[model samples]
Target: MMKKSFATLTSVLLGSVVVLSACGSGDSSTGTPAPGGTPSGGASGEKVTVTLAGWTSSADEKELLQQTLNEFEKKNPNIKVNYEVIADQYMDVMKTRLIGGNGPDVFYLDAFEAPGLIQTGVVEPLDGYVTADFDTADFEQPLLAAFQTGGKTYGFPKDFSTLAMFYNKKDFKEAGITNPPKTWEELQDAAKKLTKSENGKVVRYGFGAAPEIARQMYMMKAFGGQVSDDKGSATFASPEALKGLQLVTDMHNVEKTSGEPKEVGAGWTGEMFGQGKASIVFEGNWAIPFLQTNYKDLEYGTAELPTVNGKKGTMAFPVAYVMNKDSKQKDASWKLLSYLTGKEGMKTWTSKGFALPTRKSVAAELGYDKDPLRAAIVAGASYATPWVDKATLPTIMNNFNNQFIEAYSGKAKLEDAMKKAQDTANKEISAAK
Candidate 1:
């Protein structure tokens, strides 16, 4: 989804209902007063209420957030958090509310979308509120750097995700592979051996490629390719970038070991790996909980994404908590932001295993420092590249991916596809600007 500020109309509707309900219940405990206002826990002051909206609706995440908020209330006694769940297609819904001036005070912002929202001047900068003690240094540099504009930081990273190689243990054993591949050559060899065929039909593929922008970003980085120039202009036409695209296309066209999503009729690599149709796949840490809960019997293990030409690299997709620029409760929002993204809250949220914390201290505190899966993700952070470019990247990426698929399917050469994408992306970026 393209990142844009949400229209606040729906939020206004939702907020009205919440306010009316809070009033009718006559429970002062349900709401807190706005920042700089009188304490709401006593009879003399009015209650203040702040709304939080995000795309996550997992029962566990909601409960954990509620528990955290309850603790926040207990400490402050003057603040109450009214959490709202934004359904799927959150960007559309959020854009409406933001444009309508009724958006939530605080919301989750993906790095991909953050640049666009910041461009619209909808997000508030947090540098003024941040103190030296907030330990901005504790965050992974790349993650913390994503939310900055003109040398000023605007958001606090809540969680991060990085790609890793998830291999099917059973498939490897059947293929006579005793260990996972450690280098690109080993990976290619294993993939060739693991591919199974029966009666002229492939029973299981060695790998699966989902031709999405994010996956390609990691692949591009693997070959030391720069997706965007230093000035944030499209540069996929460069030799390094084409080399990355060539690697992905070769897996399908040249090696014949990897199949595209369309060929397998599988929606994504994660699903293909879970079904045992693919021996190895690259996916985010979020897949951990999904496999644990849904594919309970699947024997799988994760390793660092294999090096490209002997160099290890991956992409980091981090989402941060960004406050509305027009929010009236700035101080209150900052407090909640710090607490939610702080070491304590990060530990609680990441412990659920859906994501990796962006905070180095939190990861260490949660024992991810030693956990193999978590360590792979954490280790990639240093070399990880952001998933966005300057403001016009979303449009550029969309056009690039649509054409890049042709190369992945062997319909076109990698150089031709990438050159076309580069030209098209440059035009789009120029037009948008």
Candidate 2:
């Protein structure tokens, strides 16, 4: 009876807005809201609708988000959610909408882009809306801390996935290797043995690499290099950063033992390994389900990323839910945000293991720490560097990847490429300012 009433109430309130589908876009506005955020109630007994937008994902993933949102509506009868999936170039579209004041009340923010977007003054700081029951401390400190600055909480991580070494058991057995690599030296040696060639034509690469900044940020620090200074300017050309990066790119150019997705006609490393094109790839928990669904017969094992420079390090990618600064329903949106990232909703969202819960309590309750496939990924949370940086990361990475590819392909010297990428990145950053 209560659920039915809630449904009817949402219908009546949104009748004029035309909700043709559960998670479809609609043109609706409630006037410009104040900076701190608007309070919930406008009328004595009126229902408030909160609009949300996120990037389009797989059918199953989309359905899971829907289920999570439905649960929120059930718990908070007075608040109704209007969700939509933005198509390709999600961040580009989202930024344009926010600038035009047509953005949703709440949306997903990748940690990589959080610093820049928060600087734009369009995202609401979440510190003021938090309630005592939200139990903010339960979330993994590193993951939760990514969205914070100057004692202000602007977003809360909904889930996180960390890098892990995914190796093919068949390839290892055939190569007479009983264990995955534990150190960089061991990994390079193992790669030589695992690599196969027929008639002087390489048949399988020993390792698959993404060669992007997101995947290689840790490499910069591995050799005492820094991607940027505190002010967010590009500083990745330092000798230490290049030294660390050259170590991995050398595997591709110097030894010809590594390649990325395009070189093998695979969409990603997961596909490259699943199709038996590569023996090892660094992937996250997301790859587990992909491999399971597409290549059920393939046997594989997971391990912590090979120690670099005698130090254990890996990258963690986490996304958070942030509220729009211009939304009139800020109070209502906070309710949904808190509920979605809160303990109960996270358990339901992560129950199927599509994503690992960000909350320590929820992760313990789910027992992913004991699951073989997920244990390595969970263990990385303690040390993994969040996939985030100063505001210029997007621009800096674009220029770096453009030239770094040439260097990785042996078309340019590693040091030359680093200098070129850094100069161009710094110039672009200056031009923008």
Candidate 3:
């Protein structure tokens, strides 16, 4: 799950097939000067291939990406972008290539991995390359800060997704629930009421949950728990953290109103909710297109995540366009990078709604805040925690998720599990450095 398969991907089976209509072609610069092309620089007038690397999600996703690149080529005739698709193990492949000095001029970097890569000095800091037209302030602040360390921006976020609660309208009506829960306690009560059983087996779970660190980080903070310290040490085993997480384990082992998607034979929350096996699930904007295409008949509504301790919070996952520090075409890469994240390019990329735009202006232009299904997701952006931490977050998260599953399943006491996970994570972190 390093590349996060949680992203909604289009396929014939899913019935969500995004069509990518072709854009302009890459004719030589001499053919016709691109309108407002990259500013003149070393070899801006000469044809140069600037390679880009990213992981393609599906045929539709890949095609849409290519369409965006085609648009870039049309605007910058002198710079030809060579797009490379890393099919699997994207981080491993990209890291290897970068260390070997064969990395793409520009490539995709998950915010999760940005901190570690930035620490290695392989990512080109974008602060010096920013143009007033690029508008760094236009980016959602938390997302923009995810790629910055020591006050230097190493990348510009390309797109982002935030967690929001999706509930089945039909289920709610049947259960006699008048409104979506606004607080964690209310959610629990509603979940118990919505859960249905048949012949001693669950017909539908009230909540479909993914017991992982990424989904529960906000919960950790709800009760004033520190997910990790400034030094990247695992500190989520404290009593305060457990207070927040008790709600999850209680929902699973005590209340029994919640279950993982796998328990219902569904691949993910979207599948669980789509098949009517779950009444509610917290998912990102990716779920909207998925439900529309595959479960057209499913009745659903979205809301901002239920408040925890009367506080609003959710998680935001963003991916960035990072240039290689060693790239021979730094200027060309910057030109393409700035344009792709620019207003016009962002609009084109996000118009189809595969992902949400990172730029505030682009988001306002797209009117997602006014979109019925997307409004909740957009609302969470204001208070959501960007899903990034010190470079050791990957390790700490792995340790917590691994042990916490045992607690969720009733095999281990949450108190003991959290302590074990924390100690193990800390030891590993200490060893790594």
What local distance difference test score does each model get? 0.73, 0.80, 0.81
TM-score of each: 0.87, 0.89, 0.90
TM-score of 3: 0.90
Q: Give the Å error, residue 18, model 3.
A: 22
Backbone clashes, each candidate: 17, 0, 0
- Locate the minimum summed-lDDT window of 10 residues in model 1: 1-10
> What is the C-alpha lDDT profile of model 3 across 1-433, one tens digit per residue?
1112333221221332222222122223332222223232325377877778776555777788788889989988877888876665677777877887777878888888888999988887777777677778888888888899997888888888898899999999999998999899999999999999999999899998888888888898988998898988999998889988999999989999999988999888878889999899998887887788888898889999999988998988888998887666667778888888888888888887778888888888999887888888877876888888899998888899899999999999999999999999999999999
Model 3 residue 157 lDDT? 87
Which stretches of candidate 2 lie above 4 Å from their native place?
1-37, 42-44
How far out, in Å, is residue 34 in model 1? Answer: 13
CA error at residue 55 for candidate 2, angstroms: 2.2
lDDT value, residue 189 of candidate 2: 88
| TM-score-best of 1 and 3 | 3
